[model samples]
Target: MTELTGYQHGLVLGKFYPPHAGHHHLVRTAKERCARLTVLVCAASVESVPLADRVRWMREVHPDVTVVGAVDDVPMDLGDPDIWDAHMAVFRSAVPERVDAVFSSEAYGAELGRRFGAASECVDPGRTAYPVSATAVRKDPVGCWEFLSPPVRAALTRRVVVVGAESTGTTTLARALAEHYRRRGGIWASTGCVPEYGREFSEEKLAELRRARPWAHWSEVTFGTDDFPLIAQRQNELEERAARLGSPVLFCDTDSFATTVWHERYLGGRNPRVEEIADRVDHQLWLLTDHTGVPFEDDGLRDGEELRPWMTDRFRAELTRTGRRFLTMSGPPATRLAAAVEAVDDLLGRGWDFAPPLPERR
Candidate 1:
């Protein structure tokens, strides 16, 4: 209340489901009042924000304050009296040292303080000082962008992936759109592409295998069947890293779904790992390149010219079966680029500049 001072060690506990400005205010208030401040980020398995990501945000925002990431599997129904002990156990594990004060804007602060033998203080208990909450942020993260950190915004930013069969200009179209967004100038003025990590991996493996065993064909070896999962894994990792770089939008050359399509066609079945990663990588839009009359240029790695149409059919069938949103682009590079640009622009136009209305109280 009155400047919140005179405490040696202060503690603050929160879900930080997706940290908003109000949480920032509470932590900063505690940090100013105490000699040492500990902000525990307690996350459940079902929470939208992962425990590691929340810890990263807290540490980045308040580098001086000690931040603890606690994982609690116990159910989170406040009405259930059984949850308190589970919560207390998690708190004790994180904040082991004796605390002098506990600061929070919720009534639970008093009870939490009692468990630590610390005095309790409420800061902005009525939510008048800062009008944001984690619930409001989660319901409409892009709309509540102003209150979120860069890492959180990066996580929320939608990635549009351009994918298709081999020799269908996936890289060309992806790079073109990325450059177009870069030149358009806005929050998306510096867009980046998650280049096909699979292609890179394939080229490397091709050279390595050829050098090691001249008689061995890549198609006959484990490289054909076993390498896709690793490629998909690396591709996902690169996409996440690109997102963390803070570009408002990412134009991915290809996605793990495309890799699964290739796996189904080449390896005779599906790689379960690739399928699992495909489910997790959320591409806002899929721009499937049409194989209509686009002459297949022999790029050292492609022996699938005859299989081009078949692969295209495979991609179309899978997209339809999975119920994914996609637009097929055919014609010359210019025509395809124009169509892709229009679709992406429509997505941007619809999603841009949204300010979520204040959430209704439960």
Candidate 2:
């Protein structure tokens, strides 16, 4: 083990409402200067983000430090000694060990250190390194998307999935939606569209069969009951990966939820495993591309022209049964795209409704 250096046991405490880049920098600075650092994440009962989530995010970003959480419902009043004492009780209960140093970027660092009988070390008190705060993040996450980590981004990204029968413009609409967002430029320039993994899997299976027996056709490739679960899992994994790296809004050609419907269309029954996998992820909106008036061109892999109406109805039934917010797009290609874009714009207009934090005493 490495020998102790600088302060014996340092401390950093904050609400960590969403754990922004500024908070991360402060913790990293303290960790390098102290042998053992304890980060106390103090959250109130009224905060939107959960205390456990904040603790988990902090631990994920800074694994070297000891991260703990405490419910500090005591009202904030820097001038009141009794309030400070009450808040300190909560902090002390969470961290009873000796604190040689208290690191912070807020004005309360001096008083906090004095009360704990430790040196107060302020890092970037002026927010020069990263001009971001939890308040700013809560108000407009898209404006401050650059400062967020992947886990937070994944949690906040608005996922929009497009599902429909074969060749009904699901892929076309998904790509068009992503392109429309990208045309907005700025932060929206990095908008992503996750292609259907199931399609790729099908293509690979056909290719493999062709190598073994060149006479094998697309219809010859059979799907086992277990294959749907794998498809759903991979589709979810792809969606998550794209969400972590993409813009505020992520578009999916088809998601795990759509996989369940396809499983029923192929195998004639519900697979509990596929349904369970579908329920794991959350999608904000579903655009069901209606098969009416659209011609289904047989792409070798697709053999479900007659099953188009049945599949469309199944999608609508499942979407409604599961209480999912969705819109069925019909008419010409341009009309469908326009309606889809309008729905997405409306979804974005309704800003993330983050519950306000507890009011602080002025």
Candidate 3:
């Protein structure tokens, strides 16, 4: 074993409700000063965030340290010995090994060390490095977006996908929405727009056919039953990547959900595998661009003007059948953009409703 200079085994315990930068800093400090550190994530049943999610976030952020979680329903009371005993029982059950050092930034650190008969080590009790808490994060996640990890950001992001028939301005609207948000500056400047992967796949297929046949037209390129699933899967992957790197709101030209409709349009039936892939990721809103009066530009890869009305109705039907929230956009370009902005603003205004934690015992 390596020579030990500091505490043999250290312990850091907290609710870690959503695991912010402060929690990560504490874990990093504890890990640096001790040979082995165990982070005990105790969550109550009343909390909206699950214990398993908190444990996973901690483990992902700090892979070197040991992370464990336990359902701690016991109400908190610092002065009451009975409540302290009850809470300690839960903590001890999760971490049965001997603890030589107890690290924390809260006022209860000394008492916790005394109860464990270990040295109490405090790091940045002033919260100077990362001035953030679970309560603050829960209240305004957008304001605290920078302090969160990528996984947490991806989970919290509001994904909006624009779906419509050929030449219905879905791409234009998606790009406009992204630009509109990006102009807001600050966190919004990093707003992302995920383009349709299926479109790219189509272009690639056509290009390959042209390379071989040279005289083959876009209509000659064919799609198999298996192709729809791959398109849907790739669309989801692109959306996920953009969500992790972008701001709280992510706009998509089209998504996996739209791929299922395309599958029906081309293959003349439904693909269960494509539907399953679409169901994996959650999208907040779907803006359906109306094909009415919108000129269908063949774009070389498009099917024709006659199919637009059928495709639009199919998308609306499927969206309703699936119970996904959606809005239909029509009229001039400016009018459609204004309506879309209003809907998105309303969605953002609602905010994340994290259930309040159990109150401290009086």
The 0-to-1 C-alpha lDDT of every candidate, in the order given, reads 0.80, 0.93, 0.93
lDDT of 1 at 106: 88
Report each candidate's C-alpha RMSD, comma-separated, in the order given.
6.4, 2.0, 1.7
Candidate 3 segments whose C-alpha is farther than 4 A from its true place: 1-5
For candidate 3, write residues 118-186 as lDDT tens digits: 999998999999999989999999999999988788888999999999999999999999999999999
lDDT of 2 by residue, 33-118 (tens): 88899999999998878899899889988989999999999889999999999999999999998898999998999999999999
Candidates by TM-score, descending order: 3, 2, 1
lDDT string for model 1 (1-362, tens) is: 23456788899998888887889999998888998899998877755567898899889889999999988776554455557777788889888888989999987788778878889989998778777787676565545666777677667777888988779999999999999888866555657888999888877777788888876555643456668888888888888888766456788998888889878877789888889988887778899898887888877777778888888888888888999889998999999999999998887656533233222232
- Give candidate 2 regions above 4 Å deviation: 1-5
Worst 10 residues of 3 by lDDT: 1-10
Candidate 1 deviant stretches above 4 angstroms: 1-6, 13-17, 20-29, 32-36, 40-147, 210-224, 350-362
Error of 3 at 303 (Å): 1.3
> Which is the better candidate, 1 or 3, if ranked by TM-score?
3
Candidate 1 vs. true structure, TM-score? 0.70
- Spell out the clash pairs found in candidate 2: none
TM-score, one value per model: 0.70, 0.95, 0.95
Candidate 1: which pairs clash? none
Ranking by lDDT: 2, 3, 1
